[model samples]
Target: MQNKTRYFIILLILVPVCFSADILLGSTHIPFSIFVDMLRGIEIDETWRIIITELRLPRAIVAVFVGIALPISGLLMQTFFRNPLADPYVLGISTGASLGVALFSLGGGLGMVAIISNFGFASSWGLIIAACLGALMVMLLVVTIAPKVYDTTSLLIIGIMLGSVTSAVVSVLQFFSNPNELHAFLMWTFGSFSGLGWTEIIIMACFIVPLLIISFTMQKPLNALLLGENYAQGLGVRISLLRFQIIIVASLLAGVVTAFTGPIGFIGIAVPHIARMVFKTTNHKTLIAASILIGCNLLLLCDMISQLPGFQSSLPINTVTAMFGAPIVIFVILKGRKSRLHYS
Candidate 1:
């Protein structure tokens, strides 16, 4: 109770501050003094305020959503696989979205056709839907085969195989692409938070917010999930149904972010570990909310740093995320191992 209350309070305070920080600490440092003055209706320079509110502010808001969606997806993936290392991208969703983008960029006439079909959302729709479908397909294959094969390793192998297939297809698309299209596609694949605007943010909010609400609401069943299928089933939880629910929410959350933001690394895999480390429990109720906050703040911080001082062009958001994510994941694994050993 104490911990949950703490997180709830922390979230309200932290989220707003982090949001403000992202607004203030970009390529040009807008001092808190200026930010506060602007907020309080002080007569600041009109140009700076417009730039902050219209441009930089939206990007910061988008980062908060990106942070929320990716980590929550990571949490769902870890729970689904019962593996500490599982991430949304590891299950082939990222690869699938990558493949979809590959098709858009490299397919020439086919790419044009796809776009014209309002399938043109490739820049967004194509990537997101492909990711969602691809994740579901992989999960479906794993669950269906799990009972028959009676081995978790088999499922892992199959997932890797799916990832490979997506990779190969992407490679083929790359080979024949024209230089201009390829360059455009490459730039997008690098990932950045600056691309999203109000329209995209509204679209993201409509989907991600409800999905998170559902994820938390279903936390009890998720906790039951850690005990193994039969154990959970014995507790009156329908394992298959529960897994399906989680996958649906996770896939959509992950796909939507990846679609808009490009394949962001580390957050989906590392954030849960951070949350679990802080909270020290498998109780999904607390774990889910805490993970969201930590993930949001961390990503916001990373986004701010990516737009570093004296770096005029800005580093890709994915690059910053991967840099942070790789170290965080390694730390999580070693700490998790030590924790398990101590418990044993």
Candidate 2:
């Protein structure tokens, strides 16, 4: 308890530090004095304000929330399934997000205007709704049939097959899209933090804060389940009910992140493993905090790298995440390591 509490405090401090570094240390090299002045109500040139607020601020804010959402969702899924490889998006969440964007690119522009005007922010919720619904449909199908299958590996393979099918469909959409639309769509898929603004950032925050709170609330049940599903039920966990909560929370986390950031591939898988290595515990309480800290810091590192001039043009943000995320995932698999109880 003492160690978990100490680590949580450390993590809370780390988020602000990572965020400050991201805002202050960009390519233009605005010194700390000017950066402080700019943020502290001193008026600079319109260019600086515009650059800071319009471009960099949105990217930084979105980076933080997207950073929080994915890994936490991945953490929930991994715990629920007792399989380190299970990510919220592993069940076609990313594919559903891709197909939503693809369909919107073809028929309407982002579809934000259509969904809104009537629904307000609730309508503004469509991207996540599309993603959640798609993920839910897949989940429903899996649960319905998983009873007969008896083997968990088969369920996992079925999910992979579903993902492959969605990928193929997305490819077909890409094949027919015109050059400009194709370029736009391709850029979205590559995933840059450049385009989102304050409104989107606010919405991402609205969902993420609540979702994190819910995940914390479920920590006890999650810890019990870490002992395996049978043992969790012996401890009075209502298995079906808990599974539903985990799935919903995990899907919401993945859907919101995917909607705004495009399919960021590796954070969901890599950050949980990193957290496990850091905290050396299975308690979702501490693991959650560590995962959020590491996820935000790691993304900040990736974001800084994205702005580098080493490349003629910047590499996409998703590309950078995968470059780091993939190797860590492979290492975790090869090591075949697992979790440990945070408390007796």
Candidate 3:
């Protein structure tokens, strides 16, 4: 308990450090002294001010939230499915969001445009709504099917099949789309933290914060789940209800992030495992807190790297996260296999 508490405090302290670093180091360098002055309410260069406020600040904020959302969702999915490999991408939620965006942006249908415009949304808002609806559709489907399946593995396979189908649809839409629309859609898939501003952040917070609060309350039940479904059920945990809540929370968390950032890969799958290993416990209470803090730091670090500070060009946020996360996932799988071999 003491070590865990100490680790938590360390994580909390790193939050500001990572956030500050993320904001400070970017394509256009702002010296630490100037950054301090700006933070201290002293006037700074107008160009630097714009760079700090308009560019880096929003992306940093988005990175923090994306980091929190992905790992938490991954944690929930991993616990529910009892599979280390379970995540939004594995369960089709991210692909569903992608399908939604592709349908709206690349569908090239005037009817969809007319319908969205009637709601008084500009193009960006329409795209966001489309992604949300797409995710919601998949969530409903997954929830509806979850009860019918006898095994978690079967449910996981269903999710993969759904993702495959959505990917095919997205490909079809891309083929038929105009060159400009195709390019725009492709850029969105590359994933970014840069384009989002305050409005999008507020929207994400509204969904994420409430759901996150609700998730913390599930700690006891989630811990029960770690002991196995039979044991959890014996402990009076409502298996079906718990599964429903987990699916809903995980889908919405992943869906909202995907809508804003475009399917950030590997973070969802990798971060929860990182949290579990770091904490050395399956208790959701510690795991949840650890995942949130670690997720924020990791994503901010990835965002900083994606900016390619000394270069004129930046890599995609998704690319940097994948490079960081994929190896961790490989290590985890190899370690699991090695442990099994040792036991056998």
Top of the candidates by lDDT: 3
Q: Which tens-of-lDDT digit does each residue in 30-99 have in candidate 1?
A: 8788889998989888777876988689888878888899899888878777778787776677777677
Instruction: Name every residue pair that clashes in candidate 2.
Output: none
TM-score per candidate, chains pooled: 0.86, 0.85, 0.93
- Model 1: CA > 4 A from native: 1-12, 41-44, 109-152, 335-344
lDDT of 1: 0.75
lDDT of 3 at 168: 92
Model 2 lDDT tens row, 156-271: 67767887887787787677666766676677678777667788788788889999999989999999998877998999999877877887788778877877777888899899
How would the candidate models be sorted by lDDT, starting from the highest? 3, 1, 2
Error of 1 at 198 (Å): 0.7
Residue 210 displacement in candidate 2 (angstroms): 1.2
What C-alpha lDDT, on a 0 to 100 scale, does residue 45 get in candidate 3? 90
- The whole-model C-alpha lDDT of candidate 3 against the native structure comes to 0.87
TM-score-superior candidate, 2 or 3: 3
Backbone clash pairs for candidate 1 read 115-120, 121-125
Candidate 2, after superposition: displacement of residue 331 in Å?
A: 1.0
lDDT of 3 by residue, 230-321 (tens): 99999999999999999999999999999988889999889888887878888888899999999999999998898877888778888998
